[model samples]
Target: MTFNPYLAGLKTNAAEPGKGSSGNIERPQAVGNIPWQTRPAELTAFEMTLADALQAMFRDGVETLPDIVARLNASTVQHPEGSWTEQNYQSLMNRLAAGASV
Candidate 1:
């Protein structure tokens, strides 16, 4: 089995409703048996890229907790196919405060 980005995107959105769709209904899907714990670096880099892209997209310069959270939320909404959630955003903010990247 192999990883299908389309199916993964669908699964991500399915895990949480109201996030919208990925528009891959007719695409042939691939299945995979990869372990979640085996992808830390990949996941982290992906998240970092997503956060950076989101920041670039809405760059007014973050100055406060509320502002950061709002921007994160907007980014999550914008990229509904990614693994962004309220908890993940909070964790990212905590990591940032602790001098770490997403």
Candidate 2:
């Protein structure tokens, strides 16, 4: 599975309707722009090692799929502002599934 650096950096601020001191203010645009000055390259060796360890755990049936998902969700919650997303989840799952069949 391919990695998406863009999705890794995706962030959104909730739009709220309010007034400064008078009337209702306009809703802000839902822009998909990444706030980073520059996008970084591929994952580093440590990151790859971590990913590999997780993948191996999945591949070896060390944990059930649900357990893995739960752990991932917990991780996302613990690091809410970090670079984990649905795309990353799918990619990791796909890779693990493919590895399992091999």
Candidate 3:
């Protein structure tokens, strides 16, 4: 947790112009990458993970198991476990049937 831009060669008062140590402009951590930012690489929703989205889709569609799995693999949603094979899809349903949430 030890961090301070001064230790990484930045001036002790360094920050955005006119917003140094006393002006409240948030400083990026000096230990890692400079000019830090928060952004999603693939732009997925934060409201639910892939598993929850899959379960909801399956419940709403009355398709066959294979059809459901195929749609899941083809949809815009990304799988957390690489790809969703038939075995993995079955196990996901099994867990849901046993009252699991994402």
Q: Tell me which residue pairs clash in candidate 1.
A: none
Pairs clashing within candidate 2: none
Question: For candidate 3, lDDT tens digit of each residue in 41-101?
Answer: 2223522466466577768874687777777777766545767678887786576445344
Question: Candidate 2: misplaced stretches above 4 Å?
Answer: 1-40, 64-102
Alpha-carbon deviation at 47 in model 2, angstroms: 0.5
Q: Is candidate 1 or candidate 2 better by TM-score?
A: 1
What lDDT is reached at residue 84 by model 2? 46
Residue 63 lDDT in candidate 2:
80
Residue-level lDDT for 41 in candidate 1? 29
lDDT of 1 by residue, 35-92 (tens): 4422322345555666676577567666555665566566544433354466666676
Query: Which regions of candidate 1 are displaced past 4 Å?
Result: 1-43, 54-59, 77-90, 95-102
Top candidate by TM-score: 3
Cα RMSDs, all models = 15.4, 14.8, 12.6
- Please write out the lDDT profile of model 2 over residues 4-75, one tens digit for every residue: 343444532233333122354433362333354242444545455557667766786758556665565555
Q: What is the C-alpha lDDT of each candidate?
A: 0.50, 0.47, 0.54
